[model samples]
Target chain A: MKLKGVQQTNWIGVGIFVLIVLIFPFVVTQSFLLNHATFTGIYVIVSLGLGLLMGYAGQISLGQAAFYGVGAYATAIMTTTYGLSPWIGLIFSIAIAALLAYIMGYTMARLSGYYLAMATLAFGIIVHSVLVEWRSVTLGASGFYGIPSINIFGYTITQGIPYYYFVWAFAIIGIIICLNIVHSRVGRALRSIHDSEIASSAMGVETGKYKTQIFVLSAIFAGVAGWLFAHMSYSISPSSFTLDASIIFLAMVVLGGSSSVWGAVLGTVLITMIQVTVHTLGEQFTFITSEFEHVVYGLILVLVIIFMPRGLFPTISSWLNNKMSQRSSETQEKKAS
Target chain B: MLEVKNVTKTFGGVVANKDVSFSFEEGQIVGLIGPNGAGKSTMFNMISAIFPPSEGEIIFRKQRIDKMPTNAMAPLGISRTFQNLQVFKNMTVVENVMVGRHIRTKTGTLRAALKLPGTKKEEVSAYDKAMEYIQFVGLQDLYDHLAGNLALGKLRLLELARALATEPKLLLLDEIAAGLNHKETKEMSNLIEKIRNNGTTVFVVEHDMDLVMSICDKIIVLDQGEKIAEGTPREIQSNQRVITAYLGAEVEKNAQ
Candidate 1:
């Protein structure tokens, strides 16, 4: 069998993960952690796309939260102002996000490294400013409210268990789709672009086109997550989609391992857990402040950059691979003796 | 068949390639030889459409391709290897070759992400074809190895396999034998002959005279951005201008 780009999926691990997700709500029965898990699921959808764009395609974007906000506002306005269904709002959210991403990425894809990062950063700030300044359309600083919950066949997805299941389903589907792309010929070409754009183009992989396409796709993912976030909370402010949020999305991918889909998901979960822990600790102790979260994140990013530059998942996986391979070789030698 | 018509490439004030021209027929191993800064690589870059020449036209299979985009060359049946090796270091050997099959495969990002049956079928064929090229270049054992782990000679062969995976009608090899030992160079020469026999036109730039003279059906000599001589190896060796350009006037006088 041709085992070039088609790596074997770890089905057993996936199965165990599915079981945990299915049983988690029943086992915990805590609304706080369940809500946090649901939010983690939504963020995973965004991080997966960012991982493909930054980690594999080698394009940096600091405007993902803008796409997320665009998705949220698209659904928020359509459902609230126009009296449309949440589903219709979701479609519009994804479409608008994708369109804006395409327009931005067409010109932005040509820039690399710090230039691209700064451009995207500026874009995020601009979007946030529009959300705040456009008082009539976006409701300004008061925030957009009255967004309806998703209704599926007479069942409403409320903030706790139902929302958790719904969000996790989308996250799982997102994982499959991202994994599919990463394991195919398209994945190879994207990675080729990451390594060397000139070489990629020479190999007949249109580097500019691929970069723009991935950027748009990532925006769409963020938009979908935004729609979910807007519906789940039923209110969103411009503050949520700030430059800091985009940086957090990037950090999630970078922390987990940008190259792998699961790494992005893991990174999102870990970051979310950290945030929740910090919040809980801050409430329980006077010494621990809200600002402590940023300090921890900064420290983690610095340590990750210094030590495990490839990110957490890849480093851990490679170590596991070495151990497994060594054990197999040892067993083979013993059998031969 | 490929044709270079009066190509002149000027970088700022310096003339890299001045009004130089040559053409070769299909299914032949052609060698381009020159001293340092003889504009051999510049000529190859022009043919491969890396950049447009200041004045010239490169016709490939009767199509004028001098002003085309670099990516356009692969679809027009042209592939090349860089002297410094530009293989994707993070990818596996077979995966790197699979990337070369990009022009041949039509599965886009959406279809691939969806895992469509058609894309899967195309991917399998590409993988099989990539493996065949890897085997052709004798890298079957290292097919799964990351390209970054390969040695210099192996990296060059991997690059060749990748170019071959493109299934180009014309292959441009830039300094393919520059760092190879005698045995490896001999193997590369044989491989070039084999590639020609298999109906792919081979264009090589080399400083290794023995490998070039033995394998090349025709040799073109360049000196100071101009074509000094073009003929069979024996004819090029006998040409006074070619000898003098390579060895200098004093060395030729001493030899005589």
Candidate 2:
């Protein structure tokens, strides 16, 4: 539906964002840089799902990587063990991830705020342990391999330039879906539930139903991201799907902006860049380790929470809005005089 | 028509509502009034299915709904505003009201994501309906404003409009005019009357004596979780029991 005064939406900011997504690969030529870019796209997809729970439904989840792992492993086991297409594996991924989410989200039907955060944290750890201990299926902690490259429309994306575009294409679709939801009745109900569960229930919004639905939807997004990452990396270990990855996903959503859809993408890009930078520095310095990456992420998360609590996109967007409006008003005055 | 038959609610050792039995005929502006700790809100909550009664049953349109969940209350033609405004602060005024139209609309997550044919049409109609109520509440100019930014009177009006958008058969106003000044209270009274005239049964829980007396066709009074008196406004005005309940008279009032 069209909001009456929605014509005043910041189109310039939207255009700039579009430009960034489009030119990112062309701007960054190195394969190492391109790999980070690909990861950014995947993280954006997963974090956008988190945004649905965190931003819209007002539920925080730290178990996204479990869903991500479920999706990736589904892709790995189905194609490698059962001899199935990754696309078919993709369908199984969604189904399994949805099942996992429903089973886990059942506990969250009445949970909220920090209690929910803890539940999801515990759930993430449980899924991580399963991924590790399930030696029969997951191939144990040795990490599964021989995962085939992703084939989109009869073509393989080797993560060169085509894979970058491929990952981003899905990211763009994820963005569109997130945007469409926030403008729809479903989005409104989730937001209303977030504002006040009592009032939403009073208004005949099945708050629990919406909460569970968003939880499942968020899992599906993480599953899909996990699908992409599994095929692209040709490998996925328990370490990749641990609580650290889940926390990183949460950090991206927070650092981007809580409720802003673009904030998901922005936050993912910023965090991914940070990861790449730290990894690059670690490679150069012999003593420095990947452990150093966690410290950087921790510092950034704390700083963002303290300073830009609402995240960068909303704050920066508002600043841009003020600047644009002030300039236009000044021009209008000049023309009148 | 709605009936509360011998409903009793106990919170731990405290009885919030005891054997509260009454019925409202269709199309009447009914008021539930009482002093502090009178269990007026507790009664409203039970009726709205915020919680089930400890004993007794509530029949809405002749269906037993004592166990229905709170969200089910709206679709069953029972919608209510809160004692405190619960308008979504992050949403625009129109969006806040649109949340009420949720039960009426049928756009699921997949359909909403795809923007299917029925979804957009339903959305447009919902938008038009939300606007009509926004205008009805005399808030047409602030339709796009954030609901939290509106003045107190307008916020109350927004809640009413949101409740109305549910297309309810019975509308419950919980202290709808609680914090308004005299002029705003009068406007709220008129709005309640207009809603009643528009064919939705209006049941108001209020402490504003003048506002309640001026608009309500029937007044039901509660005190200490029991039904104290039930009568027309004129009868309630002169009722000795009500007077004693309000003024703390030493002697018991004669019941006629």
Candidate 3:
């Protein structure tokens, strides 16, 4: 309610993103590149949710990838073993994630700062351990395979251009939904929670309740990404849902600017691109090591922490927005002269 | 009307407020005057429901509010400004006031996410309401300025505007004139009177005797966690106990 939304011009960024999402698959013909791009969309969805939690609500979650794994497993088990529809699996994935988060959200959110981070990290470790130990249902460490490709209205979309278009559609929708929340009363409440929890309570905002709500929502986002990942990859493993993956998602949020939605997507794309790029160049840097991808990512993460600690997306985007406004004013002056 | 009955608040062995009992009728600018660590803020905190009193009952509008949560007070027609400045550092001036209207606002997260018609309508009205308070406190020029960027005096005015936006029946202001210049204090005194005249009961705690004596219809004095005197401005000015409490027996020595 009484929340007056952030009145910044957000539509311009939204417009550019919609255009790019529509034309991106058509222009990019290489299947290898297209595959990585598709994965980027999935990461974008998760990171945007993380950005909302980390940036606005001022809640840190290190178990987001655990939810992602849950979504993937839900899809992998429901469709392959239970013989259910892929759509149902996707929905179940989100539901399961939300239910798990709802149970622990309030207790964990009430513990601020380092306690919150450690709580989430412990949750991630537990989830990952379950995925490894529970062999009967999840296939354990051996992983689940032969997941059916997603199908819509008699069109079986496989591992090429169609899959790219399909997954990016969800990313585009996720971005728009995120933007809507960011500029509305929800965003104001979240930002207020971050600003001062005491003042927010004084203003009638139940800080704990709002924190729990956002935590559940962010978990669902990661779950949705996990669902898409299972169907697209046709297999699943516990390693993808580990604490390291969660840290990378956090890195994505920080590098892109946690408060900015587009920043989340940009950060995901940048990190994913670097991973793909460096994997190829590992042979070239033979003197250094075979695990060059880790070296490159670690370096970038450190640089981001040091030089652009506030986040690159928010800083750069605000600067660009200012420049645009200034040029427009200059143009008006020129016309007057 | 508001009643604080035998309220005693203690943290461990230290009693911050001890057996403090006082009440203010509707539409009165009541001042709670005390020296530092004299339990004025402790009283305000108890009445505002920041924490439950260790021993006492607080009645607001005939309902016992001693057990209510801090957030539950605003909706029960009670609001307060903090002794320490508590403006949302991330929000604009108007946005801070809008947050004060949180209790009255009824939109759900889903409706806000979808940009439904009711949410849109409420948002516009909330903006208008926030702006009205911003102008009331004479911060229309800095309506869009980030609250963290404002001066201490301006922030105090912003807090007043925010509390007023809640439209509380009983408003507790803890040191509303603290850190303000003479002119600013004068304006604040006038605003407090205006707020009282508008039908909201005003409860203020302050060390500024000049401002307190000029505006307060009734005054209560606290010394070392105990209420020493309660009367009108003239009675409080002449009370032997009040003088002895403030001047600490030095006045009684002169009188002897």
Top candidate (TM-score): 1
Instruction: Output the worst ten-in-a-row residue range by lDDT, candidate 2 chain A.
Output: A1-10
What stretches of model 1 exceed 4 Å from their correct place? A1-8, B253-256
Best by DockQ: 1
Q: A110-211, model 2: which lDDT tens digit per residue?
A: 766677778788888998898899999998998788898877688888867888788888887887787777778888898888887888998888887778
Score every model by TM-score. 0.97, 0.95, 0.94
Q: How well is each residue in A215-315 modelled by candidate 3, as lDDT tens digits? A: 88889999999999999988888989999899889988888988778778889988898887676666577664636656766787799889887688978
How does residue A325 of candidate 1 score in lDDT?
Answer: 94
Better of 2 and 3 by DockQ: 2
DockQ of candidates 1 onward, in order?
A: 0.74, 0.66, 0.51
Q: How would you class the docking of model 1? A: medium
Score each candidate by Cα lDDT. 0.90, 0.87, 0.86
Q: Which of 1 and 2 is the better model by TM-score?
A: 1
State residue A139's C-alpha deviation in candidate 1, in Å: 0.7
- lDDT digits (tens) for residues A143-176 of candidate 1: 8877898999998988899899999999888888
Model 2 local distance difference test score: 0.87
Number of the top-ranking candidate, with lDDT as the measure: 1
Worst 10-residue lDDT window for candidate 1 chain A reads A1-10
Residue A275 lDDT in candidate 1: 99
As for model 2, its CA RMSD to the true structure in angstroms is 2.6
